[model samples]
Target: MKKIYYIILLNLLTVTFSCSKEDDLEPTDIRYDYFTVSPDANDEESILRRKFYEDHNIHLLFNDTLRHEQRGTYADGTPHWFTELLDLSYDITSTKNETRFTYIRDHQKQKEGIRYAETYILPHLDKELRPYSIFLVETLEEYGWRWNTVAYYNGKRCLALAIQGIAELEEEEIKERCIDIFYNIVDSKTNYYDEELNDFIALGNKLHGETFESAGLSDDPTDEEIYAFGFLTWSTWYQEFPSESSDFTSFLKAVFYQKEEDFKVQYASYPLILQKYDIMKEVVKQKGYIF
Candidate 1:
């Protein structure tokens, strides 16, 4: 029944997605304010009715109230255009969730590729206004879906959209942090990746800074570059800890309702993924996000 509902939902999402394939419809010009919340938006359904009044004089749009968001067209561009990728529904199953879900279950390879490809072929991942600037790519590996390559948790720090190896994470502190980052992106308002996150890469470690510099990038790194850098760097950082997904998020203090932003942003600076890398490593070893 869930699968049936999923199919029906996909069809509906795609129904209106058959818009012009022309390059003329610039993303910045697309009408994202397609819906409006009434004055009576205090109900459970209006939980994510969105504070459209929060519009900024910036290039990116951010919606902090949503429980879930998506980066690609797995849902045929539904809940799109803003940095939050806003979807208020409590249990929306998206491409990211299914991708990570593979780790929860053994590979059902027969279906993953085709489903993933079909999802990827859709007109999601709008580049000009691509969420967090993370783009999509195909995997050279024999298995894994194409759109599954990258994912981002709304409030968690694992902004995995361009990140590889990490499964689709629909969980964590990345959510609130994501909102804060969006606020930053809009408030700061220059080209986001170029100036705002330039220092986010690690410098000396083999995981990120030096590795990114080794990529021969010029001027600044693209969103994909930052995602790759975070994935490689953090993967190595958490490598020594117990190898469970829960444990990994704990070590990084990436769970919900936690004050991990200080820890996250401090490391988010260019020199290393964690400024107090030693501290987090020890904290995880001692108890592991249990406080």
Candidate 2:
């Protein structure tokens, strides 16, 4: 009787294993489509984008709408998901933490943006310092404030440029915007050497308790006053001190845009300023940038 019971248990185990093996061999009806279609070979815009990708290692998205995903938790701790269509707008409200929806519909402006980048922006920037992708859009407003010509986003370094009125802008205005955007990109992307940054911060600290307002300096400082106070620009002086990373970026912008000789002469009276300038200059140079 015991042997018969054991035989029955073995048969049951064999049947279970056979059923599991059969289930494993069954095919499922699920599919995943993750690959992006390549641009048309004969398209002029596509050719230009491909060239940028090949030459500068940048993905120039002139005619594409990017999908931005944002995830967070609701007030009651439930998960919330958001999908935003990235485009340009002039009157985006700050009430919601998202921009108003739009699309890149101006082909002329898009082409102009690409040409402007090729002519003035891309040539000046080092390949390593360039953002992975540049999105040309109609207008770019962050949180309903800071109407910027260019803004950098995320570790992948996606850059967005507002090119709504590219054709309408004067030549000088276009050049200024290009340079401004270039410096802004460099300021945000370049990683400074720690020792150099700390030294620069130390120099800034030495000027503690002294501000342009207290020193009787002009709110809009002349070149001479800017050097004397060891601040490279009125904006940097306005910061009062460089206590954070963003403040350091301000210093970098001031230095990058100023002529080297003028910077040296202006900050001559302040040893700390000169020291900070030298440190900043060296660090930037090491990153294959000239300012």
Candidate 3:
């Protein structure tokens, strides 16, 4: 009887430990690693050729340095992917009714809207035999996240540039990870005090909430969209508020729980977005944006 009792207790403990492990993992954010490399990336056509080649060869080839340089800057003197063209002539309603320009020279007007493709946008196209840059296309196709530049002969110039080299050097895991990272960024909070641009990160989310009487959520959102919604809303709230609130955990609950009604009403109370953004920025400066 003594031995049986000991065995029974051990079995109970094992089950408890197993349950605890599962519970602990329930809340952990999913992580992923993105690797860069692909066969198509090495193909001759995949190179980002310049208009003029100073090298021995008469023709130019893709230059990675230029690509990085272009990607780093903002269109209208900001450092963000989307460069909104604010129209001062029009009222607030007309502010959003302006043409978007790709800061990168490539996507600029072609022959005054009639000519050969611009040089800047080429390096961003996928040379894959089949349909390429589906992810980018999907992102653009979405209602809230439209490309901010003019559509070139191929497609949105900046998006093409974004996918160019990155496309052919295909790593499914990396692509997925990149998308995941983007979603995480959109869903995470921003801090208004840290920088002005970061504050705008939450614009989409605010508009979303303002548009819908209830929080706007479709039944089935992709992993990327789910992450984006959370990150963007968090960013907007965080940027607006600076102090920490006790409702932090509860706010997260409302967000993930699809409690749009609860979230829209309660997110104002939680100030963790900016606080967390600050900590994240300090801990990983170049990595993820904090607050």
Candidate 4:
């Protein structure tokens, strides 16, 4: 009877220990499922996106439904969810504080933009130079005043190009848009031939007294000052002297787009411009680009 009592007690203790151990055990991992939609694999737009991804390792996110998470409740008891796309632009002049949202809704324009990129833009850029993701949207505007084609949000590139009359755009217009896209990518990534770029800036400083303002140029400089400073385009010139990076991009555009003979003829008197152009041509040639 004593042995039986001891055995039973030991068994009870063991069972209690096991139960306690099980109860104390906690989950090491926790996961929450997000309800979001992705582009259909078989759809036309998705097919183009997949092809672009496979070819260039670039994600063209046109139709992927961004997950909307509940943030907080509004004064009217409505749930204020976190928006996937945030308005990066700000209006200092306005008294109102509001957030705006924009998205890509047109399937046709999305397809057209992707096709344009694959055909006109991707060929010029090396695989490493391409952005990880490109978001196609209808319009990216700030305070209903200024509109933009390209805007960077959360490290991703946003293209607001699907306007009302997209289908009516001429071939040349489309190609120009593609070139703008190409320019943006190249400008952001590549450091222009450093020595040549420095030389160009030095030339500008020599003529413009170290800075645009120091040379007596106003906030909005005239065309004469812009040309004299060796800026090939007005867009590249800013209030102060343009950054070295921007000067490189401008030089690149001049060499890449315009014919050498035409550029030489146009800037015949400007020896500095001619020298910079030569440097850009050599740099582009080294990168395996013909034009």
- lDDT of each residue in 172-265, candidate 4, tens digit only: 8866656655555555445744553555556665543245567677768876667776766544344565556667767888865777899899
Q: What does candidate 3's lDDT look like per residue over 186-227, in tens digits?
A: 233333333533432343244322322224544443434433
The TM-score measured for candidate 3 stands at 0.18
Weakest 10 consecutive residues of candidate 1 by summed lDDT: 133-142
How high is the CA lDDT of each candidate model? 0.33, 0.59, 0.31, 0.59
What are the clashing pairs of model 2? 227-266
lDDT of 2 by residue, 133-240 (tens): 776666655554643333322223356666666678898787777666666666655644466576766655455444566667656556666556555434454634
Candidate 1 local lDDT, 1-291, one digit each (tens)? 999999999987776575544356456666544234445658532332232122211111122232334545645656554344333212334332332322211223322322332233212222222233111212211114453333333211111122233235343433433433332222222221233232322232233223333546443555445443333222334322122232223324432223566656644653333533443434333331222
Cα-based lDDT at residue 182, candidate 4: 54
lDDT of 3 at 143: 18
Worst 10 residues of 2 by lDDT: 88-97
Worst 10 residues of 4 by lDDT: 151-160
- Evaluation by TM-score, superior candidate among 3 and 4: 4
TM-score of each: 0.19, 0.57, 0.18, 0.54
Off by over 4 Å in 3: 1-4, 9-37, 49-291
